[model samples]
Target: MAVRYIPYYPDTLEGQARLDNFVRTSRMLFYKDNNQVKTRIQRGMPLYEVTESETVGANPDGNIVMHGECLSTCAYLKDKGIEIDLVYIDPPFASGADYAKKIYVRRNPLVQKAINEAEQQLDNSDMQEFEEKMYGDIWDKEHYLNWMYENLMAIKSVMSDTASIYVHLDYHIGHYVKILMDEIFGEENFRNEIVWCYYGPGSPGMRNFNRKHDTIFWYSKSEDYQFNDKDIRIPHDAKTLDNFKKGLDGSGFISENYDLDQNGKIPEDWWEMAIAGRFPKDGVKRVDYATEKPWALLERIINASSNEGMLVADFFGGSGVAAAVAHKLGRKFVHNDVNINSIQTARDRLVSAGAEFTMMEVRDGVRLFRNPVQTMEKLVRLIPGLNTETNLDKRFWAGSIYDSQKGKMPVYLPNLMDSSSRVMDKTEMNHIIREALPDLGNDVKQIVVYYIDVEDIEELRQFIHDENTQTDIAIELRDLKQVLDDVVIEDKATWEMSQVQVELFTKWQIKMLTFHSDYVMKKIEAFNLIGDQQHQKKLANNKKSTFKPIKISDEGLECIEWLSVDCTNAQKDAPWHSDAEVKIDKTGTVTVNGTKTRNLWDATIQSDDKPLRLKVRNICGDEVLFVL
Candidate 1:
């Protein structure tokens, strides 16, 4: 049957125009590729190597944890021709809340060194900005819709034709997102609007009824999709069993000829599932993640939609309930999220659950050199009679140098490193020169080059000299470092590390361990103060503020959020086989002096392994894993 369209406010001419623009932008998904900074890194980045201990080895079906923007990660999967059978994303509900987790300082030497360096660089006021927020849920209605639309479009591209996707949302924007999902996945593919109702403490409100339920919109990629109804049946109580018997006609079962299966009854659209907080302290699967869903919820979704060995994915990956549950159910999974805290939490959870997954992040091989053109501006100021004009084409030209005696000379800043961060070779240099030739007109006689590092300076000069001779244009290669040294350019070159090391330490027993990482310190230094203040204020005002800012101490352990250790069997060939583990969930309390301090995690190990595998996650979700 065709979908019936009702005339709504958005159907009006003016509203239609706005909606059309949004749809167009969503289809194009320009935001994913428009991040120029990230694009540059993607063009030149390298994947971090999976260590021997982390590798699942020769298995094509092992799970994956990707730390990146979901859109980019989904696009990456699509480009790789990997299709997922099931995708369940619990994206931000646009609830206008800031989620955060408290982190502690690890008492490791490497971490201490980073802390010392940070203390020297930043003052007490700067340390106040170290609070880690997982992700912001606040968004302008239009912006949120457009962002979700683009991500959905990208996600749909990587889904198998027989795939199913469950989008978890709440009262705020569920209805609007349904329309967007219908447009992208087709109205015919719409399956169910599953209402996940839970009982929790409620407060009286004058405006409306208490909202104690969240909506999960299910959609299939095609008409033919997987639905294992038997796997997701709910148990029938004695009252229901008796009622069925009463309804039975002459036959021994319900109705005239029906037979009741031993398996439980199939669940209806309205489901009664408890939230994670309602679980007891010793519950089978309860992790104190702010937005964590119950494992049972994920289990039902995964079992009903996908079979064993089928690929499952969750891009939002909060606390990794879906991935954790999916692994336990014997399904291959891929989880992606931008928050380092989520990544760390999910990695630890999955590892402790005996799931083998490789961790990966999109990283550029060459660090982004800060203000390369600013150096050129400095050079023009230092040299006599040298004036420079900014160029329209930033890719090749930094600016053009103008001299009263000499004709306009174009300046080019060639990339010192190739896509892989290796020093540019002769052929690469020749290509750059060839591409720049057309832009340099007959009036232009000289081209100034500024480079940080070159493989062979003499060879490059010779190559440029030969090109100059052939084209009757002088090509001058100038070292950028030398120019900075000679002329005072108060600029520091900043570069991001392609790979960061994860430090692990074992205390006395196999059960106890400590972990430290410099990655957390780096994130703290890079955190934007303006954004942090806004986030802190938002968190403070909200009733859901579970995080308390830790007072800065000399130890500088404020960046460590949570840590998990999985004591895997050392004698066994499978590194992911866990014997026992400990999970440390830290929170801060105010001291008498009004100082917020976190309790240390002195874990008691239950396994026999001497060097336990530890996963240390910082507040931002970045993690470092090593043998302690």
Candidate 2:
């Protein structure tokens, strides 16, 4: 059997290796249990396939994913030659505390006290206390800055020559990220340290002053970057316009031969906009996500910074306000987040706002399109016992049918990414199933394909023929049932999985794997923390853990195969076997299946006074790794 493993190490390590690069046991591994692994793999597979199938387009060309890592977005979009126009990132405040959703009301004593004090001190009605608690002293400032800097580096490469980026932070990391942005986008393109004052208030008993504002650092790739100044003009109130008119001599309305009303005043750097809050008056139902930015704020920045049809990218999209506003205003937007729930919220918000798009598929080189939800459901129906939990289910739907459908018939399924598979409607599913049916035969009989693991093909055929030899064509379920009364279910084991067939299988597989991985990883981490010293040592003392081996999948194999055939940048970035070599103990050898690599761990060794720790270095940035 020809098998390929996704490389866990790079050919070379670039720059100095930091302890942070390793998957710290303290933090949950990306895929810990079979479930979590399955989810990541399954959810990720369809997306990966869809992305791989996309044709490269010049300018702002790329798919907008509602979920997944930020690095993946940069990698995906870059493959399509799509340099982003602007990236407005508002990542979680990185406070170690869990961010609870507000669906069920619960009070944090500390937060409550702070809010009360903020209310008492507010001298302006507009000044809200929410900001002071959430954005003010939330996280360790240094960690926020460092975490943000590392993530922003990935965003830096995706910017266009005429692009600009905005970093939304509070007094905490605003100034710090600003300095980092100055370094990244260049000091010359550092446009402004915009002060957004939601309120003008002061705490009466404070020693220094009361805080009532946030900051956004604007940076551009070049001095001649896109800034449609007129697009963000503030209409002078009737009085100011009248005053200007009066100053003009009458026909006279123009001492100079220029139209006055046509020109609006350029907005000042200090913007006084309403802070996003729970009140319905603020516009839209309040979403449950913490730190949701107001659409109005995004509107101002997007209008001033970019043009229509240009791409607007936001990686740290909490409620997807920026992406929602972007799509509403006719601009292409790509919003990314690691949290599935958050991305779903964004996608639903967009769908509700009436954006049109559909997932597509390409069967036998004939592209077909269908509704996203329907596509997912049809896939599930096709594969027996395969539900959304399987890794294969999502891949089968999203990769094959979804891609083909989106490319072929974009009309039926508008706006590809929808809510979770659980939320899809049956009506939508029916429409999608109808749309996705292969253009096989014209006789009205519904023919669905199945992929089973059984090895007896002749037995399966005989069983099917014996069972349903008298079946005939049918249109409706009622009609099908009439025909099925005489027909039999066929067994076609060992048949190749089609886009439709695989989509169904992959969904169930993905869910199962993700749940398994997440569960296992959490247990492993917890056990290491509280388990016996020897057990902890056993878990931690690894060149690579015995429990956690570097394993690659068939998808990974395909990516490597593509790389072998096509030396494209997209292929080069695919997860594959690592080619890098790191210094290791001559006595120790690390084994992955039949292959062995030098082991970095030793029985008796130290980096300085510390015991030998397995370290991985990537010389070439091609492989994806799992560390124990």
Candidate 3:
């Protein structure tokens, strides 16, 4: 009999101690009923469902774009018994860059006058809001690796046994992640480390080689996987073509008199492909996204790995290139990302490309309740004679509570933290308590720990007792529900408009429409509240200095960022025409109908009996479609 060995690295003594305790107490967290444990951990997280207005049910073989965390979204698919045939993920490279997009808002002359007058009255305190962040790639090395590990594990669970995956990365942490993928997919299953080389304009680095390529690690779930080499063949170079010999087959060339077509050879592991760049006049496949990949890059990957009608997924869908390419190639797709900007950009691009797909989102209202420290703070305010102190070392402690009878008791709280429904085990508890023990002093006799739900409390208590035989400390487990009795927080989103107003502009001989919505900016806060402390602080300063919250008004429109109108008369299968659009860029420049405007939009339209479809996207990418 042999045992398997797991590889891990802990840089410091404290990290090593945490790992030791984690391994020792891991058994106590294993539950017999896995579903029960999952339910408890996922109780307050949002449940993902398709939006009715965006559903394209008639197209059964179409694709999907889900706006949510990939981990939970993948688990949701697994529960539905939907297995993916191909996976291509271009996740964050941990490059420590803050990516943002310049969004434009359409403005009316009446609205501009009101805005100008209001600005003068306030002494220029108000500034226009426009730019929206996509997602941040900065992370601590350990945290980044762990985050990638959890997401990869969840993604693997939804992949078919015969499926292939392509993990894209850069120089920063690709080597570290290569080992992780080897462990998860197995060393024997490693397929190829494809190098994607590209040339772009940038400043020459004096200290190091100019980085111009990215690594794409390919792996398969099983030995038997789908591959189509002929579909991805390229044209041979002139030198290779000249070496071919005349073949017996008509107009064919061969190396040794065998019939072989003049078509190019198979591409090697190193590929030469240009990245997607801006060419507004040249009809190139380019969007305003900062990190968009060329369609050729994704097309090759999709064609070689999967067949028509197979499900292909890109969980880290940056600009929807994978979904767009997948749709064009007649393959089904599931595109997901945590950033709302990515969702909006993908939705617009796919719809414009005539992609029949439904839009979905995980209801995010339950997130505010899942924070342990916030919930504990509420509990302390509600309950008397319970004093709490903050611990700088521990991550999830609302601080230790001081009850007169219990003396100074250290309190521990567990949270969902991410999209996974996995509960914390005894090992994690031991690690947290061990770090906090020194601060509590050696004389402490008792400690209290609270959890939403656990597999076995007695087993955890026994494990803790066994580890601390030298000291007599009684470990007690408390249910978290005891603190959250009948408390509820209402959703902050509010709307004021009931209908859209369309008026005939007799002088311009066109229709003029006025859109109104106070709730347009309701979800703007979600984008700013992301990442660790440094990221959050950067977001806060950006919001404070560059933009201000739009004030709700009944007589004038506010907080609307982007608007598109579809004037197509056909009811079904008709392409969505961009009749008119308005947006505000990052520099406060307003543009309407592809022309710069003086803080206003000159919109004109023809009045028609056929219903007109309008899509209004707010600053945070939350959109609502209306028919008039």
Which candidate number has the best lDDT?
A: 3
Encode model 1's per-residue lDDT on 271-378: one tens digit a residue.
Answer: 888886343232235554679898778888999999999999999898888887888788999988766556766766665565777776643222221122222334
The per-residue C-alpha lDDT of model 2 at residue 300 equals 82
Q: Tell me how many clashing residue pairs each candidate has.
A: 12, 74, 7
Q: How do all models score by TM-score?
A: 0.55, 0.42, 0.62
Model 3 lDDT tens row, 1-628: 0011111111111211121122334443221233332332333222344232355434587467886677657756765678899999998888888677654333344555665678743222344444555555656665566667656766787889899999999999887778767756776778999999999666766676678999999999889998898899988876555555434344355435554455667799998887863322422256678789888788899999999999999998988989988888889999887776777678766755667777776543332232222333356654444445554345545556666676766666554334332334565665555665555666566777766544466777777777755445666777655556555432122222233355642211122344444323433333333323446577778853332343444432334556655555334334445555555433334545445555543333322323366556554454555554
lDDT of 2 at 148: 54
Model 3 lDDT, residue 32, Cα: 28
lDDT of 2: 0.43
Q: Indicate the residue-level lDDT of 62 in model 2.
A: 38
Judge candidate 2 at residue 48 and give its lDDT: 29
lDDT (Cα atoms) of all candidates against the true structure? 0.59, 0.43, 0.60
Please tell me which model should have the higher TM-score, number 2 or number 3: 3
Query: Global CA lDDT of candidate 3, please?
Result: 0.60
Tens-digit per-residue lDDT, 392-422, candidate 2:
2222232212222222111121222211121
TM-score of candidate 2 relative to the true fold: 0.42
Better of 1 and 3 by lDDT: 3
